[model samples]
Target: MSPALTAEIAQRFAAIALGHVRREYPNKPGHVLAGPEDARTPRELHPIFYGSFDWHSCVHGYWMLAHLLQRFPQIEAAPAIRALFDAQLTPDNVEGECAYLAAPEARGFERPYGWGWLLKLSAELSLHTHHAWFDTLQPLADALVARFEDFLPIATYPVRVGTHFNTAFALRLAADYAEATGNGALFSLLCETALRWYGTDENCPAWGEPSGDDFLSSALVEAECMRRLMPQDDFLGWFDRFLPQIEAGQPETLFSPARVSDRSDGKIAHLDGLNLSRAWCWRALGKAIPEDDPRRSMMVAAAEAHLAAALPHVAGDYMGEHWLASFATLALEA
Candidate 1:
């Protein structure tokens, strides 16, 4: 097992975050150009989230910083973290970000992925009680919430991929926000959608896995989403049927960590994330089961194995460095 999170690790992770959160180039801007004027720098396009490789990665990177700062308020990074929030989360900046979203050409801008993380960031900041970050960021976050309210009704089928398109991964984060903030309407919609999409899934084919750009496990993320949306008893029963072979580890792919041959190539780097996220799912799944369940051992072992595979590689390349820590933090916390 890994060591508990400490102030030192928290500061180091915060430093990694600060190093990239504002370094605006080598960027992957995921936007639609409505006119020639739209082709500006990342900062001009997104004043708050113009760093950390891409918009979603940057969004979650900020989430990581805020999460760590809140957890370890005495860490050296806390002051800088607060200052960054003060600077970037201004009403003008947030309104600018929202204006981009209101653009008619940008309906599917970040879709469920970035949209979910934006809410997660909002939820994280809300924990900072008297702080201005949450209220300042709420408008942008609400814009995404509105997008979700609009998007989920028409999104009858969940996107089952292992990347940004995966609807389950998005829903899991969105569920966190809905629950934390007591958004009854969104939470109900999420639960209903999750049950409708995955309640009947059984014997998921875990093989043919690890697509080149897969940072998610389609099977496991779906299980995670269901776990969030359903009651513990209902989730356990559904999980048993969904991955019926877990006790024996029959669908071995789910138990094995992915191998990353090239961390420098952005797409290949996703294998590292595949490993970390699998660990997150496994650890979470393990906790949801009983002390004596045979599958719990399998799940724990799988989580550790995946953690071991990916922990050392969380750095060393820009492609992976931009966002791998968020997943690593998720797995480590699990």
Candidate 2:
């Protein structure tokens, strides 16, 4: 990385750290703590203003924090981030129990929505930060394993669905955490479960059938997890086959656009925008792309163009600051 790029990454990381501390968390869970100076007040956050917090929003925040920490390891913030996540451990914090949330929180609501959210959160936190603060995750893993038979057959709405991306997230998390914990059996179990979803055969045909924006996200996540766990040769082949489509600037059938209801705003389709879906591909491919491939440069150029366009629209110093800055860092890293 060039000196200029290095400096930019550092600034962006600091901004993310500061913004979360100052704004987003101030009136939420970590309000009592010393956060960033520019923290968003309770009035400014719409959901919180309405007296409710989206479970996935909290999950996303944890994921972003993990991403930033992986880039810039800070011992000081580890505990706080860990604690913020800890707040949602109860069942009340889970999914439907927002109405039942009270006093000491319960292990996130036991429903499919909450369990899926927690499963993803725990896996990412452990995988990214390598922090053991949530020692409870071990037993939680055991419980999930015991209950796997119940959650299988990934269902649609009202059928206890385990989301595509979220399930993919769980697979990666479980694999990473299993390795970290030296639990070979658990690792294998997680891998097998994930494979059941993405494997090429009839067992995982559902996972392979690309159908929606959510499915595509899940597929990309599956691809990433496969990249991490599968042999390098297989991963390379996967990349070689699909990357050409990306390079050609054509959408692949692997990802379903139907689930992306928000894309009509044209926020995601435009190359000059920070589309998360496109960034997901860039992130995985950026690390895997061969140095000799001209497509690598094309990917970087596309990401840069998006960054150039999105820079002006980046929300306040803390709201969407980390999301934008981290990608900028990723683009520079590319």
Candidate 3:
């Protein structure tokens, strides 16, 4: 994306995260108003995560900060990032976040989407084994893990949309966490579920992509998730079947990035995320394919195309600003 991530970019991303991770105003709690007693401010509802527009955005905002901090600890923003984590990631705050999630009306609150992000944040922290952040966040992470175990068996069909509900998106993010933490049970479950839901999908209809508010590419995300779980040889075979026409660029929808006409419109801003996420998937799928495969070059080209389209818009409007850097990070890292 930038040849490499620099300290300047790290500082910028960190500053964006720090600006909203604690700015408790102009928020949305996603809380159900059951009664007068149930009414509470966002800070009261989610003590550790009351900023960044919504819960999941805030979760990934932290992920972005932690990710940058891990990669560029020499940046000026590193100290502030560490200090924020030290003050906010305490056991009591996490417990409050967990308690809010455990409420009866919160059953479908963040569901698989936010569940995946929380685990991802935990996984990133897991990389910093010497840091206390992982220990401080373990309880909250464990709570989300339990939710995943309880929910996956009942989610009969995979969500194939290109938005937050996309099953592959959640599984893809959570897989990194599972592998990093050596959660064999979770990893196996993810593999099994991926095979069961998407093992036979072929000749994907990529034309119906970039639905007005879509963020993830359903077809590409599924391919990316399968690539992670399957053996290299087996995955190459499966990918060939999944998008057999890629060599000729038949799924033109994927080769060309979506256009975002309005960064300020929240729903329209999703196109920016769609482009970044597609780039991420294309890069992952590209890297995993065999060196001599012609499709590998095509995939890499498409990934760069998509990255070129969206990387510069990561910090424009509040809607895109709140979360696009994480998507950009995912694409760049992939």
Candidate 4:
């Protein structure tokens, strides 16, 4: 079996996220300044998610910590995790985040990537029934939900990149939030938007995969998005058409792990996340296929191969360390 998320692993991931989620310096802001007055610090703009190098990474870093805390409440870092949430995931902080989003100049700030992670974080928080973090964070999540509601209809074309702009990755992450909150309208919109964008895609060559700065598999992530939004049998048919030669691994790039040349260089380090995210998509797709299908085992093997290549490097360098644990958590949990 592929490596599962054990208490030991959860503890380690929680510690890594906690180490930098609140570390303010060495930051990269995605904000668009409209004027000199808008040129504020990351913390000044994003009261809660101004750490872990960038906003989106910091958002998912919080998601990883919240998920780990829920999965292994007895872990050593549980107290710290809870304390962090209690202090930061408050109404006042959430209001500050919403205020940032309300800015006219910040309309496209983080776009679908940060928007998705923020919702994912909200979804995970909702699973913690005993805590009020979800309620505290709901306003910000609602703001992003409105963004998706407004954006999807006019987004005539999908961004199939392997980087943050990928629409498939955003839809996949946001679906969790839609279902968790029982927002039927958002759920239906996500499903319909995914179909409209990717339904007719077939024989995805994946030739442009593993682009220099890519952290996602454009092909597999779209497949995973369809899997999440479609019914199982319908998704099986779609999957067959999408990647017909999965059993043979015709698109070898999807099966193979990306090689990272330099962990210190942030862009190159994204290859590690690419491997981990590929593992995530592979594992989910593997489980979706019937046990009798030959592709199931192949997908599982591919997932294991990718995980092995990337798991050991999740924390060695600060470039990868600040965010890779979240992707590793996604793969392990998937």
List ranges where model 2 is wrong by over 4 Å. Answer: 1-52, 66-132, 136-170, 193-219, 241-247, 252-274, 306-314, 317-334
Best by TM-score: 4
- Give a tens-digit lDDT track for model 3, residues 89-135: 98899999988878789988887899999999999998874468898
Cα misplacement distance, residue 130 of candidate 4 (Å) = 3.0
Model 4 misses residue 211 by how many Å? 0.9
Listed in order, each prediction's TM-score against the native is 0.98, 0.53, 0.97, 0.99
Give a tens-digit lDDT track for model 4, residues 135-192.
Answer: 8898999999999999999999999998999999999999999999899999999999
Q: After superposition, how far is residue 124 of candidate 1 from its true place, in Å?
A: 0.7
lDDT of 2 by residue, 58-162 (tens): 443444455555555654555564455465343423322232222123322333333444444455556553455345344554555444434444422122122
Q: What lDDT would candidate 1 get against the real structure?
A: 0.89
State each candidate's clash count.
0, 16, 0, 0
lDDT on C-alpha atoms for all candidate structures: 0.89, 0.44, 0.88, 0.93
Worst 10 residues of 2 by lDDT: 45-54
Candidate 3 stretches greater than 4 Å from native = none
| Models ranked on TM-score | 4, 1, 3, 2
For residues 188-243, write the lDDT of model 1, one tens digit per residue: 99999899888899999877687878999999999999998999999989998998
lDDT ranking, best first? 4, 1, 3, 2
